[model samples]
Target: MGRHSLPDQYGAGASDPRRRARRRTVAIATVLVLAVAGGTAAAVRGGLLSFGSSCQDDPVRLTLAASPDLAPALESAAKRAREADLTSDGRCVAVTVSAREPYKVTDTLLAGKDPGAEVWVPDSEVWLQRLTATGGTADVSTVGHVASTPVGVAMEPTVAKSLGWPEKTYGWLELAGAALRDNSLRLGAADPARSATGLLALTRLSTAAAGVEGGDTQAAAMMKALSQRISDSDGQVLDTLPRDSSGTEQGNPRRNQALVVSEQAAYAYNTAADGDRSLDFFYPKDGSPRLDYPYALLEQTGLTTDQSRAAIRFMSYLDDPPQRRLLERHGFRTSDDEVPDALVAGAGGSGPQPYAEPAARPASAVALQETLGVWTITVQSARITTVVDASASMSEPVPGSGRSRMDVTKAALQRALATFTAEDEIGLWDFSTKLDGAKDYRVLVPTERLGDRKGTGTQRDRLSAAFGDLAPVPNGATGLYDTTLAAYRAATGSYAEGKFNALVILTDGRNEDPGSVSRADLVAQLERLTNPERPVPLIMIAVGPDADREEANRIAEATGGSGHEVSDPSQIQSVILKAIVEAASRDGQG
Candidate 1:
């Protein structure tokens, strides 16, 4: 109104056409500009824009439970993930890796009640599938493969040569025959409950022993035979390795012990063995099981700030080429990429090591079922002898420790005795002046009377009482070799068909009664008694400062069993459990 200098005769009669058109155009232009600006702002607010001004601040932390078998590779992969910065929110992520048995880990991961981890890498894919099959609201996704290797008999070249290697594929029968027949041959594998690799190996052996094509017999006779050889429980096995390796090699060749290990470990060991050549790999002729390391993503357990970042980062890093190369250098095959030539050359001096089958063997559903069935049926027929060294030396307290060696040995044996089901045949042998009670070392009772099949409290109470009553008897020098002979003789007298036989020998000192029963003589006797057709395995547990390493090795070597040396009383239960696990199951599945 104030600037109406051009008020033409457009007032009430007619409108200014150009003015109206210009006004309408201005309104349309304003609307168009607002729509464009708001859309642009919305895009920015919604995070669809190309440039982001801010990011999540907190770091993600991932807790990973991995099978002990793949601990090495996963550890290396974890290191690379952090370096590559492939995290979920551009923040640093921390990965905490814990190594445990594949079965235990899978069971724990599947239960999913506690604050769960962000990821789990088991030694076998079968575990992953088994975990998922156990119904749950959570969805644990299987990440890309990690590493693979076939189970092999780890032995010295000389031993392998004696067993007829290179010229023929080494089957479990040959190994079993050697272990049972020869007094010098030594064989060892981890407790099935403690190691996926060990379990796979046992499973293969059980299948071969039963002549079951593609089926794992849980109750197979071979399983019982194998189980009888485990000297300690799962926890104890881990500790025993270091204990047995105690005291540096310094001019002592007997200090070196051979173990059936993963391919990567074998490679590392071979590289370090130098001129000693004490360690070598033995691929079983019965077609070894492929190790399909499965890294599964745990979805339900809310990740820590760092875990979320680590989970995404680790996966992305493994998918990258350069990081994959590092894994290969460490004797691992990448799941998504080709095996590096260097790795191939390292494996076999030429091409990649060809397994009996492909690395990614499917977890057979029928095979698993058959194996489980066999385990339930066959577990009971095994006869177990718990050998305890009640020699005077066991009464002496461990130097700088609280409990006596005898007490610790009893605790371990008690724990092992508790794991036996009713169907099993069990007996007890206390070696001192002579084998206790059972007239000249005989079976105490059929295990069925001990407890219910469901593993009830009744059995626990009976075992506890039996273990508690073991008084520390002050006797003459520990007669390990003699005690072993007496026990074996007693076992052969009443040995049953279709039954697994084992002697669990616990000692705390050297075998000093060499005048009448020398170690060499005892070993020869054991060889004759444990003839391949009637294999009777022996497991030994050495306790106290004076425990003879050489003697323990002799017994284990002669019997195809495992021997363990213990210093810590707390770890006894684990050691005994592993031995029982080894004796009860075949091919590690049981």
Candidate 2:
């Protein structure tokens, strides 16, 4: 049939009572089905689907496009649905799970436009609004609350005590003041634009600061402060929060993703992290926005018989008592039906939760709103950049270094990539020995390639693999000058649009033959890039006994970036992420 032709339910001759009653639904479904059929047929015609099964699967496959942040909860929900035999409801329901970065999942689902997958569960409701604003066609009525948690600082218990935890209601003022007072105080949070939790955290802070809770002004101010803080730190604090705070019993979180994430993520980490129960929660005194993850069925897309049944069944299972109990066991808040003692003990509920009605009256929305407004004005941004050192100093192990510079670089790079998000892109390149016969240079992936695709998870996977493949390759002298130039060119290439770029350079020592570009010449180029018209930020990182610290400073000064020196290789990753977070703001790429 042609694309415009309606489905069987909307056929002109159809006059059945059931069909008429569901006319609007049938019309919407017909449109979605035809679109899918057309796309699938086209894909098959072009050999994109690869198999005929894409067309044959009309029996109905329920695809679930969800945020990676919610993987733990929803996966549990799917398991429950399957155990209950929801798949046998004559619809041949199948749940296909696809993971995306938190802020991007909604965009991904809309792209597919299949509507065949009756349900989509994102990490936050704010993102759902973003999707809808972008012309979401689905019936939003199906959207319902599924799971939620508040944003809190996941810290080592010792760290919490040092920061004056439960005894004094740890709030943003204390947290920020402590970090400012003590250089050793490490703090972490997610990138606001990248994940709901991060955005919510920013919102909470903004609301508290501006005295305008949950408003755009608060969001803007929070973005500004967040940008400044991120600009200062460069981006290290957020990178190590999860792993450093995780409980050891659950296997260590793979170094393939960022550390500071949602409460659910923190829970997963603590569950897997094998260490002292030293980890604990630190809620901001202002009362941050709770991470409210919702599951909504898209009415715009017509679900296959199986998908329709599966979606409803899954929702019911989520609200069921047994499933709620399972969620509670995993360190999440138990349901109102039954709060497990184990969960209560683990959660350490010192205050009222948003889910259950409190024995005492809950805090007023006006009070909470006022606090959020204040937070928004005071929020700080987190900025970060990953720099790799590929100079000659890296070829050999230091006499007292214990490990080769190259080895340290690879390990640090791997750790650094794991701490970044689609929102944070690190410029990558390396300098090597240059023989008269050949050019000594290597640039892995440039900064622009990071998170280029709006909703695809490819960038994350690509970065993970690249970091995985990095190893000590001894070859040439350091080309810090030339590579920095390349990075500068990439970051500042489009200055007219008013972009904030940070150049993070990893170097073992001073620049050798700069490939015709003298040190002075390179500095001038950096100056041009950092011009107020362009404003390219710089962060220079060095590791080597004889490293040229002076040169690092000069490079950073040229671009208005910072220079950091670290002797301990183990701490480099956190330092970089924290530094970046301090430097970048919510206005910039948090």
**If scored against the real structure, what TM-score would every candidate get?**
0.49, 0.45
lDDT (10s digit) by residue, model 1, range 393-497: 777886666777767766666644533445566666666654444222323333333445334565446555666776565565666666788777776666666
Instruction: Give model 1 RMSD, 1 decimal.
Output: 22.5
Q: How many residue pairs clash in each candidate?
A: 30, 81
Clashes of 2: 81
RMSD of each: 22.5, 20.5
> How does candidate 2 score on lDDT?
0.52
Q: What is the Å distance of residue 57 in model 2 from its true position?
A: 12
Instruction: Write the residue-wise lDDT of candidate 2 on 428-475 in tens digits.
Output: 555565532454456665455345663555555666666656554455
The candidate 1 region of ten consecutive residues with least summed lDDT is 1-10
Model 1 residue 21 CA deviation (Å) reads 52
